[model samples]
Target chain A: MTSAASSPIEFYFDFSSPYGYLAARIIDAEAAELGRKVTWRPFLLGAVMKQTKAEPLLTIPIKGDYARHDLARAARYYDIPFVVPPQFPFASIAACRAFYWLNGTDPAKARDFALFLYERAFLAGKDISKPDSVLEAASDAGLDAAAMALALQDPAIKELLKAEVDKAIKKGVFGSPFFLVDGEPFWGHDRIAEVREWLRKGGW
Target chain B: MTSAASSPIEFYFDFSSPYGYLAARIIDAEAAELGRKVTWRPFLLGAVMKQTKAEPLLTIPIKGDYARHDLARAARYYDIPFVVPPQFPFASIAACRAFYWLNGTDPAKARDFALFLYERAFLAGKDISKPDSVLEAASDAGLDAAAMALALQDPAIKELLKAEVDKAIKKGVFGSPFFLVDGEPFWGHDRIAEVREWLRKGGW
Candidate 1:
């Protein structure tokens, strides 16, 4: 097992996942307290779900109602304002591509861009799936809107996002807010407490 | 909202669910502390899963591995001994029918029988799904073995179990360890904390 001091926690998530948005809100602060760094890797969960033949949580029968309530309940618990987007389960390709495009230059800015987009989609209930909305989030994060638009079309940036999704599948990451701590995979935002405990005890 | 003082918490579960086993371990004590009575209702999750098109946690790709690990990990967290049975996801019809059979006569003893069967299946790694195993658990729970054998074949007992499953589906209980406090529904073992808070505050 890698020592916590040297190994960063790998947080894998999809741009459109509400649980991913919730994890993004707290993982950094939680990790920092433990003197651990976290690497935010945004990938397309739609691609992963397609390969796994997994149904969306809202599409499942009884779980659909419970999940809808839990999503809002969790947001309330975390004191984050959440409104389900009108175009939910929307294509996150544009947002993810923008993240990679900005990440290629400044990783910090990419993180900010990700947070900005999540806030727009989940908090403000905007349709971040659109290229215009993504560009707006990028601009709000202090990224040049015109440069971001061009970068969105960059073949390398698109490939980077695709490669990330491929890597996630290869690593058996099938859910949003999936975390890898010293090669131990913890899925779902509910496992955050267990993640913290795992980091504290160095695995049990 | 139904007052907590008058409403008993409805605990709905399937015998084959590991998470249900974990919840069964502590829900009683947790509820008793708050002066609340718990009604343990066993239903066929298979029927519910069929309607939901939900795969068993161990059958879903990527999630299967995480679920296996989380099952053991959660057991450790709760200080409950758990061993996945060799014949996992075993047919729970016999065990569930036995529960309703015993429940019709004695609710408290039925709870004991449910716990007894869960221990046999999960903690002791026994195949409680088998009639012989169910008979053994029933006998251990102070039930007459010959009578349990007869009850297992009784058409009314079989219909009773089927009715419970139908009722669960109608109530939108798609997952194991589903809890109903008043009219509000909560699913999963992780929601116990929220259940406690809901009881404490009456409602959010």
Candidate 2:
């Protein structure tokens, strides 16, 4: 069974991550079905990647081709319309900063903004890696575009994203689409099913 | 809903792989339920790792910690008894050569030998990386101990494994526990469920 006091699902994701986009589109409903809420945390995977000394998935020879195929297949499996951005592994720093900036006060709007940025990169082929694009997404989500543009360049907002990534790394999150529920860590988009199981059973 | 012409599920695995061992213990039963057979193909991951330039999973920093945790959690998920070998990442070349040596003529015996070898390494923490261990496992599986011992040193057997690994690479099999069914590729032990679904539905 579930309780009202169960911790919110801490969904740590990078906007540039394709699997993160796929999981992002479904995690909330999975959480909601269990009477749980998910707190979306957008962090830069590049910083975490450096700590791991791992190359981008698509840059790693044979695995790259497999990842390319798997990503498309996984999207179809979830019925999510998808596309690789022209700059596939482009930086999501701007998007992350913008997310944490709003996350500080309007977390709901921040979550909505994060989804838009993901759809921009994955579904619409727009460049959310650009501050202008982030600001446009905020506007499209019915938020203040000009204020968001200023927030994107704000040093305080940049520091917010950095601190969130560091916190995620400290919390043992080294991948996009990582989840923390009941203080247990689950990684990868595939783990979403397991996450639902964990939520429904509390812990198994 | 079923076809007798279905191809065998091509299960490519590395002897030293954790997930591969996990999948090896269950892939046959999964195939059997679908009125299909499984072909256990073992290969050396070290060569594949060299080509991909990827570091071992447990050697990476933050991700390493996550992998160690996930491996145990996944074993629990499948309800399979598991313990990491003390000499994890040990050489599996000998075990692999012996497998192919028997697989050439007596495939069923080779499959049984593979299961014993896997249990020895993962369940009993036996040093299957050794030729002596390979001989002992073959004997334990009711296979010819002397022939398998000589098979370990046979240049012909080594070439068999080499050819198989080369063919696996060409077929885009870079990960352990990779599956090719219906001419579709699925990587990772987690895909076993998807494989069963694919067999039942033919595809999504």
Candidate 3:
């Protein structure tokens, strides 16, 4: 619980979930207020899903219904816009690879892309599976659409994402937006505020 | 969502936790009023721990602190007696096996034993790992202490307990007092009310 030499908070997220998007948006402000650094560790949620042999959020009958309820309540609580995606379970592989490439060039730009994609998927019901939709999100993030398209095709980006996903799974992370502060796992978006409170108290 | 085919909400619990004791004392009353049968399924919390590689409740630094705060608040909220146990991480294996054996003969007695053990372990600060303490709890449940002692020697009880643990893991159970009504797993004693509400809605 020492205050000195605190490790940066790592946020693991994906573009497919609106909750991840919402968490990513608020995490930086929350960490900054607590005098902590946030490391936006972008990993493929799809990869983690495949590795864990867990059903997708939308597939779990009770949780799926709860997710809808959660979004409505969360949006009202946070004063954010939320619209249900018509064609959910959007293919996030391309968008995730783009994030891997963005991790090298500009982390802020990558975060912006994530936020933009999240807004489109959950706010406007945009079809994120379409390459055009992904390209548009990159453009909104202030990245060159052509450059992002090229980076999305790069084998290195795929490899990096695969490695990150493997590492997360090995660390016993079974869900998204898992915030690791000083080696302690604070799981789920619901735990974000609590993690900040812990950081403020200089507790790991 | 059919009311006619409503199955009794099955609650799987271990007697080691104060939360389980609280739930055991009140759950039957809640279910009975709703015209739903409450099935008590006792399994070794230790066995579930081994399968999931979960640490003891006292070992989880953050959760340990939270439990102390949460349990007291819960006790007061539910108006239940809850004194923290002096020797936690007590072996719930024997208690679990006793329930497994009694499920064949008398589930009502098994439920009573579970409630008695929770009260003794948490309220009385008793070391439930001791053979005499367990025998006393079983005796309090209106069972013959001699027969309960002999049943503890049966290898079949151990196998039955292990199978329950195995079945729990297979069903994606990761915590104690898991309620499965119509195949939906609602975890923790805190979730008992939610289970009742879900059952009332006649949906799994």
Ten-residue stretch with the least lDDT total in model 2 chain B: B1-10
Q: On DockQ, who's better, 2 or 3?
A: 2
Worst 10 residues of 1 chain A by lDDT: A51-60
Tell me the DockQ of each model, to 2 decimals. 0.58, 0.70, 0.07
- Residue pairs clashing in model 2 are none
- Judged by DockQ cut-offs, is candidate 3 incorrect, acceptable, medium or high? incorrect
Positional deviation of residue B115's Cα in model 2 after best superposition, in angstroms? 0.7
The digit string of per-residue lDDT tens for model 2 on A1-204 reads 655456688899988889999989999998888777999988878888888888888889899999998888888888999999888788788888888888889899788888888898899998887777787777787888888788888988877777888899999999888999877998889877787777667666
Model 1 clash pairs? none
Q: Report residue B185 deviation for candidate 3 (angstroms).
A: 13
Stretches of candidate 1 off by over 4 Å are A1-3, B1-3
The candidates, ranked best first by TM-score, are 2, 1, 3
Q: Against the true structure, what is each candidate's TM-score?
A: 0.92, 0.95, 0.58
Name the best candidate (by DockQ).
Answer: 2
Predicted candidate 3 versus true structure: per-residue lDDT over B72-163, tens digit per residue:
75677678888877777777877877777777787776777777777778788887876677888777767788987887888887778778
